[model samples]
Target chain A: MPEAPRTGELAPELSLPDLQGRATSIRDLRGRPVLVTFLRHAG
Target chain B: MKVRDRWDRWEEIGAAAVFVVFDDPDLIRRTMLTDLDVGALPFDVLVDRSRGTYTRWGLTRASWSTIWLDPNVYKTYARLLRSGARLRSAGTDVLQLGGDFVLGPDGRVVLSRPQQRDDRPPVGELLRAARGSVEGGG
Candidate 1:
């Protein structure tokens, strides 16, 4: 099946902390095309 | 099997940003530094220690029991639990969901792989889709 926030849906603006704990928001990448991968915890 | 080895293999087709969130931050950091197994995984490898992301996404351990409980699969934990006194007691099964989302410059999702079971993806396919998005096909 296809993923959520389907082809035409707008991605929710997420302001997550990077590895260094710096806040990075999705809106920050407003100009360049972005590829987002929601990954799982390595078990 | 060394999970990091597979990670090294995917590093070659660089373009799409790579990120890995691990349950154990200490273990991941130690293994990455000492073993140098995933030396070339160009992007940040972060921690999901509290499982905040898991719950937010509707991913649950119970949901994946069928996959891990299959008799044909050879999982170390399953085997170990089987030989114990409480052998048939079904153990906790964790489901790890992953996928790629191609977002346009406007922060809209154009393509996504919603049902992947693990973090690994076909490098060729991912790059192709990513390239297509960059070309405005998405």
Candidate 2:
């Protein structure tokens, strides 16, 4: 299993589509603090 | 995850929160968002249909016992029920463990946590961590 990135490590590049299908990437959010949460199943 | 008006506080603190889910976006929007009466979230909620993000974050399948047999999950459901929230039918991926992370302005992780059972930290606590990470510069 790939170990999660630890504190002080660069976050893995996360580029995905939003609900509207627009591509979004964590790399774009650099220079700003962000809280990323992975949710299981909403249904 | 009753964000509603509380997200303004997150924005005020100069921190953004993004929700990453490995599911169909429309299904998630209809069933979950509407049920919670939450509309037009101020933050980005990315869809990870391939589970690639989960994999990168080292989140894997959770054990059946860790979910169904966990008393805390039931207790949390009961509490939500008392608060008038309806129970969602079987989750799409009960085995897929979830997680939380705080990334600093420099794009470095300041905190990394994998969810266990029903133990995700409250939004308030998350905001504080995010704020601290930014202010402390990782």
Candidate 3:
């Protein structure tokens, strides 16, 4: 039931693994605009 | 089709595109490699095994009725069928909802849209919001 971050608000820090299994975080890409999409499943 | 089509635009803007999925990296990698032939995507695909990201983003599970009764779902299924894609077992959580978000350079959210059905917030809308965020120095 957590609420999504609203516009003009800081996005929640995200730490997840890439396809190659390397750990990646949203905070690391701070200098550029990012489009993040959440998918229901891989299929 | 949308993200791939606008790949160049995203590159021109120096914006990063990331897809977060509630499944294993291996599964996603296989799907992208086999199901899609759009070459390499100019974005990173991340794995959210714990669903923590979804929770923080307020994405919830869709009801059974919503999944089956939604016209968008049927349209998507038909489209996939026409494309030679067969319906397969749900490899992951079928009810898990998804969403799109645009984050500015300053790490602030500019657009947050939680999908209400199988289809929503067209790619054009997302791209426009992203472009606006960059132009407005969000």
Best by lDDT: 3
For each candidate, report its DockQ versus the true two-chain complex: 0.39, 0.81, 0.76
The residue-by-residue lDDT of candidate 1 on A1-43, one tens digit each, is: 2225667678655455555555556576665555566564333
Docking class of 1: acceptable
Q: Give the poorly placed runs of model 2, Cα more than 4 Å off.
A: B1-5, B35-39
Model 1 share of native interface contacts: 0.51
Instruction: Please tell me the TM-score of chain B in candidate 3 relative to the true structure's chain B.
Output: 0.87
All-Cα superposition RMSD per candidate? 7.0, 2.0, 2.2
Cα lDDT tens digits for candidate 3, A1-29 = 78877888899888888777788898888
lDDT of 1 by residue, B80-138 (tens): 56768232322122365545666765666766655444334555555555555556744
Ranking by lDDT: 3, 2, 1
TM-score, per-candidate, Cα-based: 0.60, 0.91, 0.90
Model 2, residue B91: what's the lDDT?
A: 55
Each model's TM-score for chain A is 0.78, 0.89, 0.84
**lDDT of all predictions:** 0.50, 0.81, 0.81
- Residue clash pairs of candidate 3: none
Question: What local lDDT does model 1 show for residue B10?
Answer: 36
Arranged by DockQ, best first: 2, 3, 1
